[model samples]
Target: MSTVAIFLMIAGVFFFTTATIGLLRFPDCYTRMHAAGKGDTLGALLLLLGLALYNLNDGFSLAALLVSLKILSIAVFIFVANPTASHAIAKAAIDAGVRPWTRKGGKP
Candidate 1:
């Protein structure tokens, strides 16, 4: 259990690092959002899950279960909310006429 929790936390950090790289390297707004939103959401959820598991390592009790449940609930909320927010941002950008980057004329 402790090992699993440690692994999950490490995985979450790895994902967050990748997301940072993607945010820096992606060509355009939509692509950046896709990278950031997907990676960040997954990373955060994993971290939260790891935390819950770590808490549970003390042994399962009613109070411990509730704490884990609360942590999981937060993860769930973030999982649902982030993608929706990202979609909304992308839509707004499209509606306002932000154009996607294309490689054609970007050739130098």
Candidate 2:
């Protein structure tokens, strides 16, 4: 694998790990979802891009093109869906009167 591909894979793994930690450690549902949605999308995109590049090292082929296209599709889907889901969740939470965390007295 090329150095760049390796770097991408490593960075993707790091982002994914940090996202998992954030999901486990964050104090609020919205915060956790934010971390999960954004970080996972970025990490998955990086990992997929790295894999596609590695595959392309064997020279241009139908399989390589297809793999890259699939990766791009996944990225696009996440780009469209993650924010929409986050917005829906935030709206539902607001409608239900869910309160944000504050440093003051921790009440509602």
Candidate 3:
């Protein structure tokens, strides 16, 4: 169980690092938002799940189970909220006439 929890945390960190890189490297808001939305949502879920599992490592109690459930509920909230927020941001940018990046020669 500890091993699994450790793996989950590590994987979550990896996704977070990739997302940071994408934010730094992507040429446009749309692509950067894509990276942030997808990577952050998954990373947060994995990290929260790992934390919940780690909390249970001491042994399962009603209290521990409830705590884990709460953690998972937060993850569920992030899963729903992040994408919706990203979409709204993208829509606002489009409405404001922010265009996507294009090739220098005006090609796809």
Query: Which runs in model 1 stand beyond 4 Å of their true positions?
Result: 106-108
- lDDT string for model 3 (1-108, tens) is 999999999999999999999999999999999999999999999999999999999999999999999999999999999999999999999999998899797954
lDDT of 2 by residue, 1-108 (tens): 667878898888998999999999998877888888788878877887787677677778998889878877876887788778878988898799877766678766
Residue range 1-108, candidate 1, lDDT tens digits? 999999999999999999999999999999999999999999999999999999999999999999999999999999999999999999999999999888987842
Candidate 3 wrongly placed segments (more than 4 Å) = none
> In order, how many clashes per candidate?
0, 0, 0
Error of 2 at 50 (Å): 1.1
Report every candidate's CA lDDT.
0.95, 0.82, 0.96
For model 2, the stretches where C-alpha displacement exceeds 4 angstroms are 104-108
Candidate 1 lDDT trough over 10 residues, lowest sum = 99-108
Better of 1 and 3 by TM-score: 3
